[model samples]
Target: MNRKIYISLAILCVLVLSLQAACFARTPDKLPNVKILATGGTIAGSGATNTTTVGYTAAVTPVDALINNVPELKKIANVSGEQISQIASENMTNEVWLKLAKQVNTLLSQDDVDGIVITHGTDTLEETAYFLNLVVKSEKPVVVVGSMRPPTAMSADGMLNLYRATILAGSREAAGKGVLVMLNDTIHAGRDVTKTITDRVDTFRAPEIGPLGFFTGDKPVFYRAPLRKHTVFTEFDISQLTDLPRVDIVYHYANNTGDVIKALTQAGVKGIVHAGTGNGSIGKVEYPAVEAAQEKGVVIVRSARVGNGIVARNGEANDDKYNFVAGDNLNPQKARILLMLALTKTSNPEDIQRMFWEY
Candidate 1:
């Protein structure tokens, strides 16, 4: 065989391979044609050699395994998965939330993808969902699903939760509901939902503020939709995160120490959340340090150390004078979450408060 002819044949084969790869990526043969973004939650896992499947981690389950385990999904929609991360939700960072929000926004601009599903660990599920709800620009459903137990555990709740989330994503009824947390058979607004129990299959609930709805026999049943305003797919692109100002959380507790207040100021933290005691109250001991930190230019937010209900300002004097803001109904931790996101848009304490009110 001539050497030149052999070389020419190899080049021709390489070109064919490139074309084939491109065709597979762009072709739209998959069903209901939905997109599932997997973030390495318990819903996409199996049991280990021991532990009765109760404990789980973001292991090696790819996107296909989720659909394959629940073949009944085939009758509902044509879905595909994009493995985004494998870390537990507790470790999730602002950067990851921003990235996820941007990715969903990009997909929503496409004409074919009907909805987006996020599979996440239950620990910080609400935070991720809320982050998406506040930022992803779409009336198309962006549903977050997680299981209380690992799939290998007996009576694992992951499968049913996944099914419910899938139904919500495919249904036209879920439009304009914002990002949702579908777990324990309930559909909760992302920011309003929280994990009430660490071990129960029904670990998620809406507190005094209840779920928006539930799944009844593969159907989404809505009772009350949230009336809050959101800014998804708006000018709130996460690409703006690069130069965004910082936001921090300050927790108020009985005799709360001022260590964080002093530390954050040194770290140049631009914002602070005080998870205060009753009604976002700060202890006398911690107040001066926080006030001093704020005097130096940090935005101080008073949030409840308690987990439930809206936090508010009562007799806490000079809160307005000191340019401090109340967390409203958000816990200190959650207040931190919303504040960081809001700070991406503006620095004025007043404007940041309004962003919270609107969202």
Candidate 2:
């Protein structure tokens, strides 16, 4: 009887092991992991009262509060937060950009991290998004999110914007789309999206090319793809870059003395983006100073101050003769970004022009 009992116990042990293995195999797959890198904006802003909207302390809210207030996020993915900085987007600098890029690349290299979401200020959100669109080395989704209303204000938009951004980051379809800007239930390519409104939640837009897609009924939908080359396809790599080349923008206006252009040249800027008026034409008064700067070895790129349309190559002015490259639909701020990166690689106008067209 004892021998029989021992054999029975050994058989039960074997059966238990087999059942455990089957249970493990039948379990559902783990959710995608997402990281939220928070750089304060109005989304985290707090005002004196819930009724106050405009005048408030920006970047005062912590990442933990931003994440904890939205409990529904856990149902979608394993989300984590890190506070990179606490400042308004207007104060965003090149140093923060380099630090953020390095951190993003490091996280993307890890096998467990699938995607990333950035909480930024709407003021300079597009600039950061475009900068990341150019330099981030990974194909994983990087969605920059922000809100026009302060978190303390009525009808606050941060909760939903953050929710949509988190969902988009975890989406498999978001891969290889480069950096994305998700706000007002819309998805835009980082390279083209720009803030169109100052005080509205639906501020971001890509005029030449509309949004890449949108989020509806709690799901992300894609109706188009960005035609421009981005992410893994581009040549920018910021891993070894400690400092970016200095570039500035000078806007042209009637009766403008071009004093800013002369001052920028004296300040030893490597490149200048002339925000010319009406199809990127240099006004008669601003022409001599710009020409002088160009002759002083400062690369000048002509970009239109108008909200829409491209600065046509040799349309209003002879860019070839003056060695000035057309902005190619890139706004002045974005042109400054590209020029800073392009100057790092090559100073040749032709090579820089090709970079502008391709990127």
Residue 328, model 2: lDDT of 91
Estimate, for each residue in 32-120, the C-alpha lDDT of model 2 and write its tens digit: 78999999999999999998878888999999999999998897878999999999999999999999989999999899999999999
Tens digits of per-residue lDDT, candidate 1, 1-359, equal: 69999999999999999988876453336444678898877776677743565655554577778778887777677777787887777778766777787788888889888888899988888778877777787898889998877777778787777877887887788888888888888899987888888778788887898899988888899999878865453345575564446777765555667987999999999889887666667777887888788688788877776787666554453567767777778666567777777677666888877766666
RMSD for all candidates, in order, please. 12.7, 7.0
**Top candidate when judged by lDDT against the true structure:** 2
Model 1 spans with C-alpha error above 4 angstroms:
1-31, 49-53, 231-235, 243-245
Q: Cα lDDT of model 2 overall?
A: 0.90
Clash count, predicted structure 2: 0
TM-score of each: 0.86, 0.91
